[model samples]
Target: MNNEAANILLVDDEPNILKSLGRVLKNYSVTTANSGPEGLAHALTTRFDIVVSDYRMPEMDGIMFLEKFMAIQPEAIRIIVTGYADLEAAQNAINTLGVFRFINKPWNNLEIINAVEKGLELKRILQENKALADQIRQQQARLNEQDAILKALEAEEPGITKVNWAPDGSIILDESDIDDDFKF
Candidate 1:
């Protein structure tokens, strides 16, 4: 639903499943990988906003693949699409892999679509929040620097309570500015 099309990666060893999922996510920029290793390779090369992987795969399961994927791209939203209804696997996907959602093998088209949309939305929010957090850190650093400068200025002129600068870039210090009663 976002104006910017999200890049999605769908991984499943089954060709038909990959095709079907890709077709369902036609609105998004989709990449398909046949195996966990292949998917991880692609993930390393390209940044996907959302990744949907089947639970059972050769060499690496969905949980392992998603976990490794997160190591490479922690910002990417992960979703597990599994035919197996293993509660343990679902819990592991959520707890270990930080999966956004888990959809059963015979996923409803609308449900899959909704899940992908929600994943993309979460990705967008995370990116925005990260940007905002970086800005806050930068501002805090600047504020700290300003505070240090003010402290240094006060240290240099202990008696001076107020400093007025003229338009001509000259400092105006008056006798009344001296806080004689104040002790540093």
Candidate 2:
């Protein structure tokens, strides 16, 4: 695990709710957003590893926030803490937003921390995967460029010699390898 602390975003329209959750997660790096649109703006610009949102809010509900958040930052792990667990809303959260978990209102501090920790773990794994994928892509590009150079060297006229190194880092051809048809 990384020694760095987790970056958490607390989103809720109610000032009291945001303050309470912020206090609960005081040990970590916490950023608060008051509305869904405000949260979206912050999330798009900020670098948060996880987002915890209240389900009931004016202007935009948790569901809508989740949707917008997923579009902008798909790797972020999300949790919905709501006073009411309507089956329809729960289903929508799962199907549309792919929320990591759901918590009932009046949550336990320990439980919230645990969920946030789990979300951070998942985010780390995703970041690692993305880095590995980018490395592979760069390596492939380098190989392609090398291949092009090798092809160009090979296409030289008969008078030119194109020599390469062996896997053991030894030159494949010395002066003796040159024949009447090819010159160094």
Candidate 3:
């Protein structure tokens, strides 16, 4: 979960904007794409921890780009950056596209850095949680299997004494406690 190791994608049609943002976010691994189609192509080919895209671009807008990006990489964090501060676009980005943050064109360097850092942190947390859940599921499956085996053994030996684990870790199936009148 090192911030420096996280991969980020920056999509903007303006070269200067891309350059400036790239410089500001130089600490992390940043990949830039000129347009929505290019960004979408890169998204399909590579995995990114975060994606910051401009709201207005040729062929496809930021909302559409983010929506498609979500389909391809649902786990990637999405952010929208644009000079045009349209309320509708911001709402759409958040409500429908699930954008992590909406940033204006004259963004503060500190704010942008913080947003990326937080996004990466969130991604790491989600990954860890998923792994822990999987491990729990695997352990539960193993316990269920053991329980089934014990039940089968009990069905076969109705009056059999409970099996114990010896000090040496071996199973001790002692039948000395069985009543004398009981058959094998």
TM-scores of all predicted structures = 0.85, 0.76, 0.86
Model 3 agreement with the true structure over 1-184: per-residue lDDT tens digits: 8967889999999999999999999998999999999999999899999999999998999998899989999999999998998998799789988899999989999989999999998898999999999999999999999989888888998644476889999987656765778846
Clashes per candidate, residues 3 or more apart or on different chains: 0, 0, 0
Clashing pairs for model 1 are: none
Q: Can you tell me which runs of candidate 1 are displaced by over 4 Å?
A: 1-4, 161-184
Question: Of 2 and 3, which scores higher on TM-score?
Answer: 3
Model 2 compared with the native: what TM-score? 0.76
What C-alpha root-mean-square deviation, in Å, does candidate 3 show against the real structure?
Answer: 3.9
lDDT of 3 at 118: 92
Model 3, position 61, has a per-residue lDDT of: 92
So what's the TM-score on candidate 1?
A: 0.85
Instruction: Give the clash total for candidate 2.
Output: 0
Clashing pairs for predicted structure model 3, backbone only: none
